[model samples]
Target chain A: IEYVEEAVEAVDKDKWKGIAVYVDHIDGVIHPVTYELIGKARELAKKINHPVYAIMMGHHIGSQCEELLHYEVDKVFVYDKEELDRFKMEPYTKAFEDFVENIKPTAILMGATPVGRQLAPRLAARLKTGLTADCTILDINENTDLVQIRPAFGGNIMAQILTPNHRPQMATVRYKVMDAPERKDAAQGEIIRCNIDSKELASKVSVLDIIAKEKEQFIEASEVLVVAGRGIKKEEDLAMLKELAELLGGQIACTRPVMEAGWLEAKRQVGLSGRTVRPKLIITCGVSGSVQFTAGMNNSEQIIAINKDENAPIFKAAHYCLVGDLYDIIPNLISQIKAGKTVSA
Target chain B: MNILVCIKQVPDSNKVEVDPVTGVLKRNGVESKMNPYDLYAIETALRIKEKLGGSITALTMGPNQAAGVIREAFAMGVDHGVLISDRKFGGADVLATSYTISQGIKKSGTYDLILCGKQTTDGDTAQVGPEVAEWLGIPSLSNVSKVTELKAGSMVVEMDMTHEIEIAEIEYPCLLAVDKDIFIPRLPSFVKKQETKDREIRVITLADLEDREEKHYGLNGSPTQVQRIFPPEVNNHREVWNGEGSELTGRLLSKLKELKFA
Candidate 1:
């Protein structure tokens, strides 16, 4: 919620004659959210006879500016600085805080991913403005001038949050929620470079080091993830699952029930209370598809679920499924995957 | 340490349905409740209050009806409550909502820790808490699963995401968005429910806060706007199995094999 409000705070003042979208950050390359916010921003911008201007922030971020023009913006602000080459809080916030004070755009929007969440709030604070996060929708009301509509409460209530007293309405949108606008390869836009003093960087937290790892680090780090949950009907089921997990690769995992059952170590479990797993592929033969389990593995890219109920939510999110008894499914599935090669010969 | 918990009254997400033809929210009879995640946030604050010996104030903005959530907060043991409600505040978006709530916080004068839910389920927009920090000029942590460490002046927190955990410190006046695992909200008691309802529910408005009347809040200040609201599309890519017996199993197995699980 703080990040969402920060996105709005970044751009709450100024009667934008045209829609000007602030670029949250580009890895020097445009993030997917740039176009999505633009597509939505343009529609609202058009209603008020205003074109959209997209802003970009990064070190040497200017080199990456021209590509943004094609994203359908009237202008683009590229705030360049060495400190931003890697995302450090102090430098990145300085670059954004400077650009926002100058340009005074209509509504700043960025994806509500991890980076945006952290960056948006800090910038909003520096700018001293209002921000709305994770908005499902964005639009303009000519009479009220309110960029309107969003959900609140646990996705149950739809509230219209506004910053009537503030300017440069800022908001950070969740990715994949909004549609990307139509891309015109030939479309053009203006670009400018932004700078902030290095002395400004001297204060604030310093990043001694950054550890960026690929996705597979989770499963590889665990020696034995004793995953147990509702499916571990008996203490012996833990042995069966451990055996299957050992035969293939990786550790044992379970639903919350298994931990409650005292059948496995709390640290080894893989549900909500336990650790979230990103194994190369999780093969759960007995577990049901509860939202708790889904939240842990929805990002795994690949999942193999074995359950008696075909209608389980897990099956929809899984890459593979086996509809059979777990007692029967576990042993068979393990043997097949561990074979290394099929019985083609 | 004084903890300020930002809470919003939300309808139950699972029960929300769309008007089949009009593509609008069916708010006709939907009931609103404390956002499930915010419940944890309040509890975390109360727990912090219990451990650190401090005050936990509950703050929110909504219609007069939003007092129900406040009653629940009092039941759970928040030190005080403030509701930013007014006629000019209807149709406020998250941006406006934040300004109103942040004003409420500022009006109260002081706070140490700020607690909030990761995101509201309905809008699924998690912007208010961080935005409040921005407006308040404070440090923040989003989706915090635990308070790993705390001190007299600064503190460290553990942020939980899909597969990663971030440990960071938040100085006083910092914002933190907590997930359900932060701490389950105390179950409301039928006894306290009646008791707190009788307790004063502090209500403030634009007038009381001495807030700007240019309407910096309530829908007018929002920029990115929603053009429409309807049921989210159900993207189902199901392959129906019409064949029976061996044929069905054969097709299913082959499909699994094709998916690289053979």
Candidate 2:
């Protein structure tokens, strides 16, 4: 299609009135991402010159619509009920799809999170509209009046998208990357409550249970981490490494290979496949820095690497580099530190 | 599921540079690329949709030039694309960028699954994914290695870790920031270039918004900022070892002994 035709065909909303966004929320614990989407809608509504409203599919998120108003969004649709309290696919997707077909929004934005990731594709099928995921940025074109700009190919490329022939250009945004508008203390925003269809709540998926992972700290929120790779060779040797990590008051960590070798627990893995850590201090032993490995811990404020190989990439990111075998280095340092060695945080 | 994937167009890190005096990146003439990890995220979503039957819409927020990445996404089979461009968004930290993208998605209003690479090669901070999830008030799963099963409204997946696999079934309206192993990305079609520019890239500006609340759009809301950018420092020198395998091992062991590491 020609650019002009593609651009003009996108805004055909005579058949579409408003786009409804589907968000997953549990009671008492409102996900921060929903605020980010509402915040974005506040801005996007102005760009497209359309009303941007948010929809939450949970049992008790109706009270939180006030939070959406903090970002100045136009409206919030609450579909809260006992069966819809927890996230289940069939009912939630059906309800959201029905709402979308009824509201006919120009577009929808969701958090590219676990729930959104699982639900978006299914909802897109229900709505038969395009859905973009994990976009770091967004905006509209004056000439084309389409949403634009999302990164692709592991941040190597930027893609501009538009639902020229479709109503409600759909997309999702990742966390910490999008702007979350503030809630004004004095400002009171209007909240409209709509009666939801009750039949949509009965679905096939069931929430068997909900519990937090054991001994698993949210690595993203941690301040310090100590990682061991091939250098710590033996599972037994990890004891000494743990001893060292103990002195520093940090959690134990490892590379993908170490996890593959069973020297550490899977939760300790730090890399592309593992957790991406942004601790204040990240210490490494025997880990050669690969592009994949670096992506995990490269954000650490202070990096210290002890490796025998002089040419390891870990040295490049390290603030302090010690060249030697880990066997001698670790034990000696552990013993010395145990002997009341003064250490600096 | 209607899935959306977000990727970044960044200067290839290996070729990136910093202005030593200013601690700022020099982007006037550096080569750029789509983050490699994001390729896995997008492809994985596409694969899920293909099996489950859905569509993939790709979007980006950058300068007018960022449209290049969007076109690439289209060729890879994303059904549509969007470009959120505006001068006011320039130099935005993660928080601002998150708000801007959320706004664009809100306006677009068509999505079920949102996918992203764990982090970017440049900032290397994975906070954006979680932060966006926080703002959107949805369930977010990060560092996902594989989407094991997608049944009903629940997603059963494994998070690849250093030691053991973590299997969790997340409810819908969830966000997932993925690792490259999620899926092998599709190759760009040669015809993408021929047909890319022809596709309209929708762009939005600050003036386009009704509220126009400038208090925290860009730098105002960010808690962390790029205080400086520098080439990763390199230290230590190499003592090349040259000899037969036995000799190399013996020498290595001896050197360890001499260094009191044995």
Top candidate, metric TM-score: 1
Q: Per-residue lDDT tens digits of candidate 2, residues A1-345?
A: 111111122345555544344554556355667776777766766765667677776766755656666656567776667777766655666677767766777677777666676566555544434455566667755432345456443343444545555555667776555655666655354566655677656653344444444454665655557688887767888887777666655678988889999777788888889888987667687888877888988867667676788788887777666666777566666655555344311
Go through the candidates in order and give each one's C-alpha lDDT.
Answer: 0.66, 0.65
**Using alpha carbons, what is the TM-score of model 1?**
0.61
Against the native complex, each candidate's DockQ, computed on alpha carbons, is: 0.14, 0.03
Give the per-residue lDDT digits (tens) of candidate 2, residues B92-157: 656567777777766665677888886777645455665565456566666688887888777887
**What's model 1's lDDT at B245?**
35
Interface quality of candidate 1 as DockQ: 0.14
- Given candidate 1, what's the lDDT at residue B152? 83
| Residues B114-216, model 1: lDDT tens digits | 8888776565667677677766766666777788677787777766544355566656767788877677678877776667766776788787775776347
DockQ for candidate 2, please give it. Answer: 0.03
Candidate with the greatest DockQ versus the true structure: 1
